[model samples]
Target: MSQVIQDKVIDENLKWSKINHDLIRTMETPGKMWWTAVLVCVAMVACAVAAEIYQYKYGLGSVGLNNPHMWDMYIATFVFWIGMSHAGTLLSAILHIIHAQWRKPIYRFAEAMTTFSLMTAGFFPMIHLGRVWNLYWVLPYVSDRGIWPNFRSPLVWDAFAISTYLSASALFLVIGMIPDMAVLRDHTKGWRKKVYGLMALGWRGDDRQWRNFRRTYMLMACFLIPLAISVHSIVSSDFAMSIMPGWHITSFPPYFVAGALYSGCAAIMTLFVVLRYFYRWEDYMTKNIMEKTCKLTFAIAMVWTYLNLIEFSSVWYGHNVYDKELLIDKATGPYAAVFWTMIICGMVAPFGLVFQSWRRHMPTMFVMSIVLQISMFTERWMIVAPTLSMSHAPHQWDILWGSVIEWAIVFGSFGWFSLLFLLFCKFLPAISTYEVKELCFHLKHEIEEEKREAEQKAKNTSAAGSQQPVSGSPGLEGA
Candidate 1:
């Protein structure tokens, strides 16, 4: 029993030492590329802010919105950002539930993505309301007229769904970080230690604490899985519930969900690739893991393609002339190039996963993931723009080009997300050092046990050889 205790203590000491070394390495590494990413993100955000200022001073007319097309790029970008947020939650929650060991290294980064992307997404609905100052109307509260938000409205549902998912995701992220926070707290000396200490929630390496932590984590995983699904579905319903030709489809909810997963997976893959390269985590984020992630990307890509086909097929076979024309416009009209590009990128590109070489190749996987993301963005654009551009009234048919200000805001939003993630990697531990240590310990014990078994087998074989007659000596005597 004493020996066991001593072994555990030594194991923990070694673990902490390794963690401290990694922390120093992360801090010392001059992340020039990370700085460049930060600058680009900042520039994007600045443009977005400038656009907002122009819109606030001028009016809603600054954007391309009219009678038939009330919702524009803002709404499409909002949905796209929200869908991007779903990837992190899906990767973290699903992997946790399945007890995937590889997830230990990647979940922290993915969870960070979820939180920051959701924060960026939350900004859109408010900005889209034009009178951003009157955003309080969406809140569920008492009014002088004593009326509540309409429960039947899909918009209200979106408000609830996004709020719930965001809160739950935040909680899950913090909870999962407790152990790592404790590690940081212990390793740091002054102010950093104090900050991390509070965040660690007074975590102690005790059995009872671990038991509670495990139970709470399991519950959060259960909650997050369904919450993510419902959030995207509600966002899709915002379009589907509308009477617009392209928007009024029963398949929107599931199709949106699949697209969300596809894009989310792609974003996560991109993050993993970047993190692995920048952090020197070749051991943690191995080719094997990348291969597995690509397989998932391929699978979700197929689902997205199927849904696209289903949506198009229904449009083609239906008797409604309006819907038929809308479909025709999407295929051969002004947006045909974007529509075809989305198909080739989202559908055809991912088919490369069928080849074993492509799955294992890092550069190929990274390029494919980027292409998939761009395609998903185009898919969202097609959903919003083409429909609005080709309204039922021929006189109302107008091309909605994104204004300079609009472009800035959109670019800034992307910057905002990237900046947060890049800063997170720089200051905090990117890979969970403590979790990696635990995995190493587990692997070490497994190897030790195998070695012992092999040694015992060798000893047995030697004893058997001694007990048996020497075949060569016997033959020589007989001769």
Candidate 2:
């Protein structure tokens, strides 16, 4: 049995050592395109930082926020980023528990997207604050003035939730990457080795090391599922807790969660196709995975649409005059055009994903992913904007089109997230080397088991033929 297992372990394609080298090679010598992308991202981030500085010096009046529209694009984008962060942890945790093999390659980058987007999401509140220097006040602390933030405030609640989500995501990402980092530490020399070695944290890949790593990883994965759900549910509460008609729906949490997962899944498609092309990792990040992601996105899209209709129906059916009017405002109000566009993107566009051609075709899926992200972004904006625009009291109502600085920050966030992800790709194994090795190990084990069964069946057949006259004669006496 041991020899059979040993022979089965002889995988031509997945020698653990060879996989380390192959994956590490992706980071070895990036091309001109990689450098170019990094430079562009840095430039965008610089522009954003510069814009923020200008806004700081010039004051909140530098942007278009006012009256009923006090919360503008920053809040919307923040929500969108929060939503974006969901799919990563969801894919990593949920699929992992279900033992989905496709998740192995996808989850590494998906989890990275979660961490980077959360970092990006974390910044929006400060950017929205306009007076970002006072950002520390959001922390649960008392100054010499003995003033404390109202724990009852949804904003404060959001602060706690975002901080906690970001921390958990960072821990999850770092822990998962340790084994991969250790692989890099072993393969490199000098500074690179030193950095990877430190991150690897003395991971020697021994029996004890393996046991502890698996147990810890599993615990974190289990913990992250509820954490991920709660993070977005809390985000939804930022709106749902409010008295505003659209924002005050009981269904907002699940609605927001579905939207988040919807957007996150689309993001996975976007990154999946781009990285597959750029890294030429077709075998690992296959078309099958792309189609699977599309199916998920399509399913979630339907879910979001259903929630949209349900929310609308509840508002329309309810005798609450204010809520009914708000529903009317959404369809034909000042920013009704934005709402309709969102409908087309969010409610309508996902229908295309149902086709195999759209799901499997890289080009189509890429375009669809982009559309879905934009739709989700607009959906967040619509959720916040319309509620504020037509607040129950007419006097408090104000329409806000985001200022130039606000737009710049939005672009800057994209740069910030993309830059972090690109850096991660350049440094760490973009796909999990250790996980893939384990995958190959299991596949080898299964193949060997099948081979043993085939051998046993052949031997039994021979034995039966040799003993046919005597043994079969007893049973065949009638014949």
Candidate 3:
């Protein structure tokens, strides 16, 4: 009897050759839509560059950086991009360690997302500085005047944390792609072959090479898990270490980490749908995988929501008037609309994932993921702006809605990130071929084993029935 496999991770009928051909074909050619996207991203990046130049020429005043609100949209966008970077570590390293086979098909692009987003995030700190040329002072180096970088400053911490995270994450991404690079080297021709060959590090896929690769990759993944956690925690310290009311919460580290993961997962969902649909990878990027992702995203969302509520309760019950007033002002102040948008989108919209149909529906999941990210962006803004807008010294209070240049740079960041990701997809293998083959092999073995067991059970039942006397013939006499 033919039996169906429930909740299949991938189409069982897929061949290894087909997998290679389909994935590599994406890099071999580009569609009109792909070119259109690239042109648009380039234009957006151009606008952002112009805005940055304009800002640099005129100084911070061009971006509306005023007293008490020095940290505005740029810092908020920085945090949002940093948070976006976390999903890659979660999917690639954390899930890899846990032996989640479903991650194999999607983790490549996710890792790419991590690296590109870090590149995007690293710019904001420098942009926030009125004199961007003086950013080198944040580096831990001896100055000509014998000045050392202030270790206590959170900005210094950001410099160290983000650089370290970017280095480790970039290494992780590149290391993970080496085997695939070898495949490309062997398959392609001319210049592409030469490039891939150099990148593959002369990988021959021998037993020794495989063994070493596994060890190195596993070690890197193990290192990355804690590194990812600490990076975001340090980022949170940028605020938590401050004396400001809302920014000084004890729970800010975990809160920030949760928010980071939440945003990252939402971003992954958005890209997942886009890649699956654009590449026509339904056979590999299956609904079951999407459902699992949705479930994980929903779980993270709930955790984020819990942390948010906990912050509110801590401030409300701690009777810290400054913190309480800031929280109230967020809900009912100049930024009330943005605050509520964050609440509705971050806290409430994730509930849509709890429904099975919605989670499996690509269009619905795509829309929901974008909504969640918008919510997360606003969340970072609320965290930075509201606290700055209201302080213990009422005389120093000011509201900053950000200026056109600030908005342009913010818009350009998405374009920058998208351009990098789009280019990466056009050139590299976005899906891991060997890992997906392994997944298919193991799944096939499992199905065959189950089929054998079912056949044996059926045989035993038939033999027992035949051995017993027939009901109408000799069963009554035998009994």
Per-candidate clashes, comma-separated:
3, 0, 0
Q: List, residue by residue over 85-204, the lDDT tens digit for candidate 2.
A: 987787888888887766787789999999999999988888778778788888877589988988998788888888888888889889999998988998898889999999999998
By lDDT, the best candidate is 3
lDDT of 3 by residue, 1-479 (tens): 34437856887668998988888888886889999999999999988899999999988875778778888899999999999999999999999999988898899999999999999999998888879888888877867898988888877888888899999999998888888999899888899999999999988889998999899999999998888888889999999998999999999999999999999999999999999999999888889999999999999999999999999999999998898999899999999999999999999999998899998899999999999999999999999998888989999888888889999999899999999999999998899998898888888988889999999999999998888875677555545
lDDT, candidates in the order shown: 0.81, 0.84, 0.91
Ordered by lDDT, highest first, the candidates read 3, 2, 1
Best by the TM-score measure: 3
Which model, 1 or 3, shows the larger TM-score? 3
- Prediction 1 TM-score vs. true: 0.89
- Regions of candidate 3 where Cα sits further than 4 Å from its true position: 1-4, 461-479
Least accurate 10 contiguous residues by lDDT in model 1: 4-13
Candidates in order, TM-scores: namely: 0.89, 0.91, 0.95
Candidate 1 lDDT over 1-479, as tens digits, reads: 23333222113234557655765577544567767877888888888898888888887775655565677778888988898887777778887789766666667888888888899999988877889998888888889998888899999999999988888898988888788778778777678789889988899869999899889988999989888988988999998998878989999989999999898999988988877777776667777677777888889889999999999999889867888899898889988998999999999989888898988777878898899999998899999988788867888888776777677778888988988887787766666776667756765676577668779999999997887777665533454
Model 2 scores worst on lDDT over the 10 consecutive residues at: 3-12
